[model samples]
Target: MSDALDQLKRHLAPIIRLQQIDGLLSWDQQTMMPPKATTARAEQMAALESLVHELFTSEKTAVLLAKCESALADAAPDSDEVRLVRVTRRDYDKETKIPATLVEELARHQALSHEVWVRARRENNFSLFAPALEKMFALTRQKAEYLGYRHHPYDALIDLYEPGMTYADVVALFDSLKPALIALVKNISEAERQFDDSCLQGDFPVEKQHAFTQEIVQALGYDLTRGRQDPAPHPFCSGFSRDDVRITTRFDPHLLVKALFASLHEAGHAMYDQGTPEAYEATPLAGGTSLGVHESQSRFWENMVGRSYAFCKWILPHLQKVFPDPFAHLNALELYQAINRVQPSFIRVEADEVTYNLHILLRFELETQLLEGTLSVMDLPDAWNAKMQEYLGITPPNDTLGCLQDIHWAGGLIGYFPTYTIGNLLSAQLREAMLHDIPNLETLIEQGEFSSILQWLRQHIHVYGRKFLPQELVILATGKPLSADPYLTYLQTKFKELYAL
Candidate 1:
């Protein structure tokens, strides 16, 4: 039995490494790849993806998995060996359902499509990206059909990122969130007092922003010796291994919050990667349990910690030091109000916390419609604009700000948007639980002390890696199942106090 478990780990290691290499290539393509190399990169990615699919879904892998499962039949279900075999079985079943040819084509098209989306966004031309979007939805539909879902085609695709989650589950979650979010937006809009966030905008140079962001992330316990940050078209975190995590952010010279919060967001993700148990490396237990859980960590740091009044107090002096003109005159409370001001915005990533979930709701609805054939790619921009107006009381004037703002569709991430909201909800839940444990969490943040906070997360959440499912992990960490009530209460209390509603 021991030999069989060892053999299973050995069999899975190379496949896991190959997948990491694939992620590395993707990270490079987004950050450092030249414009003209898109075609070559597409081919390279396709070949690598095809080989990985073939190897991971091979007969030998199946034999080893079965052997390990049988050998561990009497072992405790929560033991690492049993969990490993269980996770591998789940992944193997899902991967083997799709043909390698489909995987290759999706990879090739994803690279090309991302380039098209980039150009279209820069040019503000949705027509240029429409064909690619159409093809992507088509391929995704085919992939979903191959995987076979009972209720909706999207269920299969979403499950690839969030195991055990279904389309119905997402719909129910969003349905519960919509009314509260809408009411919050309405109340804030009609509030007697409004905040002036001019303090967050000014002549912030790119170099200074980068340096400041590096300083901030490092202070938050993102280890520089094991990780680094770079600039990308969109901000993202890529972790190939515990020691090789990388983060990228897009800078706005006029807006300091854009880069600072983006850096915090990605660093949250990198810290999670860095904190995973070393024994899980290069195995199925490595990395995050799910994208939803992963998003919670990012949102935890980005909003729960980075956007707090306590964080403002700690960061103001540093901001004043780096970009002296605007922040030098700002007080901590004023800085907090500036950074946390509620506003509806065109860019989803730049949306205020009060309205961020509405953005996700829009994408969730559109993705569902696109999959169900109720929405066409050609009409997507109009649909997006309508939803923006309906949800946030504003409409985008162009496709770039409307449909082309996100890189998810071009990258074949149709079912990925909802995870952002899932992360947001869970972040609040985790914060609630953490505050109960460490009563001085806010004081620690104000003092720029994060090791205790990080250690708390490491002890509860990060240490498990993929050993537990997201639902299981959430309950274990928080002592309650995930509910929108905590998140809703959080937003209401914070915003009502800020706006004096």
Candidate 2:
């Protein structure tokens, strides 16, 4: 059994390395690659993806997996060796069902479509990006058919990001959350605006934002020795390995939250990557268990910690140092209230915590319609604006602030939006569990101390990597199944106090 496990690990190492290389390539494309290099980069990425698909789905890998399974038949089910084999086999079986040609095609189209989306978003022209989006969705539907689903075609797509999560499960979760969120949004909307965020609006320099972000992330235990931060059009985090994680955030010279909160969000992701167990390195188990679990960590840091009053108090001095004039008269509590102010927004990435999941829910509904062929790509812009108006009571005047806002659809990430809401729910759940264990957590944040918090996460969440599914992980860490009650309670308590509603 030991010999077979070693052989399986050796077989899987190169595949993992290739995937990491792909991630690096994607990071470069989004961050530093020259605009003219798009064509060559797309071709290169497609070729690499094709090779990876072939390698992973090959008969030789299947035989080795079978051998390992046979060898480990009597091993403890929860042992690392058994878990690795289980995850790898599941991935292999899924990959083998889809053709390598389809894999390369999707990669190539995603790269091209993403570039088109950037241009379309900047130009505020949906026509410019519509054909590419249409093609991507067509391919995605085909891919879903290849993957196979028991009930809905979208089920196959969602399972790719969140294993074992069905369309029915998501619908149930959303149904449970919608009334509470809508009521909360209505309550906050009716209340007079309590905080003036005018202080955060000023001529902030990009350099200062970068420096301050770096400082805060380092203090939060993101190892600058093993990772670095860069700028991107859309902020993201990529991990090539546990030792080499990279995060990117965009800067808005006129807004403080753009870079600040984005930095914390991406840093949360980087911390998760950097904290993966060394024993799982160079294997499928070395990264996050799912996109939902991954988003939970980012939201945990970005909102539960970064948006808290204690965090504002702790960072006030550094913020004053960064932009002395704007923050000169601003106290920590004022800044905290301003940052947490709830209002409907056009851009999903910039939405407030209270309204953020509404944006996701809007996308979730539209994407499901798109997958089901009830919504045409040509009509997406209208549908998006309608949803925005219906949900938030404000319609985007243009496509840029509407359907063209997000990069997910362009990148063929149809089923990824729901995870943001799932993550938000889980973040509050995790925080509830953490608070029970660490009652002085708010105090620690106020004092700019995060080592204890990071350590607690490492022990409870980060170290396991992909060893368990997201539900299992939540149960293990929080001693309960996934729920929206904790998140709803947290939101109501926080916002009712903030808005004095």
Candidate 3:
């Protein structure tokens, strides 16, 4: 069994490396790649993706997996060896069904689509990106067909990011959440806005924002020696290895909340990657378990901690030093209220915690329609605007703020939006569990000490990496199945006090 496991690991190593290389290419394209190099970069990414598919789906990998499974038949069901074999075999079976040509085509189309999206978003022209989007969707549909699903085509794609999650499960979850969310939004909208966020509206220099974000992330235990931060059109974190994680955040000169929370969000993701055990490096377990689980970390730090009163207290002194004019008269409690102000927003990334899930619900519905062929690429902007108005009582004037705000669709991430809402729910649940364990957590955050929080997460969540599925991890961490009660309760309690509702 040990020998077979070793052989399987050896075979999987190069595939992991190839994926890391692909991640680096994606990071470079999103951040530092020259505009003119889009074509070449797309070709390079396509070639690498094809190579990875070929390697992962090869006959040798199948043989090694079979050998390992047979050899480990008697091993404990939850042992690392058995878990690795199970995960690798599942991946190999899925990859083998899809043709490498289709994989390459999807990669190339996604790359070109992302570039078109960037330009279209900047120009506020969905027409300019429509053809690319159509192609990406067509390819995604084909890919889903090839992968096969029992219920819906979207199920196939959703499972790729979140294993064992089904379209039915998501729909059921959303159905349960919709009424509560609508009621909460209505209650907040009916109440007069209780906080003034005008304090956050000032000239915050990019360099200073970058430096201040760096300070906060470092304090949060994102090791600069192992990982680094950069600016991107959309904030994200990519890990080549546990030690080589990269995070990015975009700065808004007039809005302090944008970059500050984005930085913390990406840092949360990077810390999860950085905390993975070294023994799991270059293997299937080296990264996050799923997009939903990964988003839990980012949203956890971004909202539960970064937007909390304690966090504002801890960060207020630094903000005062960095932008004295803007923050001089603003105290910690005021800043917290400002950042947490419940207002409908066009950008999902910039939406406050109370209204954020509506943005995701809108996306999830639209994407489901797109995948189901009911929503055409040309009509997406109108559908998006209608949904925005329906959910948030405002309509975006253009596609840039309407349908082009997210990079997910451009990158062929069709079933990814629901994970943000899922993450939000999980974040609150985890916070409840954390508070139960550490009664003084808020005080610790107020003092700018995050080591205990980070360590708790490392022990409960990060150490396992992908060794456990998201459902299992959640149950283990929170002592219950994933539920929205904790999140809804948290939001209701916090906002009722804030708005005097």
Best by lDDT: 1
What are the Cα lDDT values of the candidates?
0.93, 0.91, 0.91
lDDT of 1 by residue, 168-270 (tens): 9999999999999998899999999899998788998899889889999999999999999999988999999999999999999999889999999999999
- Candidate 3 lDDT tens digits, 336-405: 8899888898999989888888888898899999899999988988899999999999999878888888
- lDDT of model number 3: 0.91
State the displacement of the C-alpha of residue 278, model 1, in Å, after optimal TM-score superposition: 0.9
Instruction: Give residue 317's error in model 2 in angstroms.
Output: 1.1
Q: Which ten residues in a row have the lowest lDDT in candidate 2?
A: 190-199
* Over 4 Å off, model 3: none
In angstroms, the error of model 2 at 6 is 0.9
Off by over 4 Å in 2: none
Q: How high is the lDDT of residue 429 in model 2?
A: 95
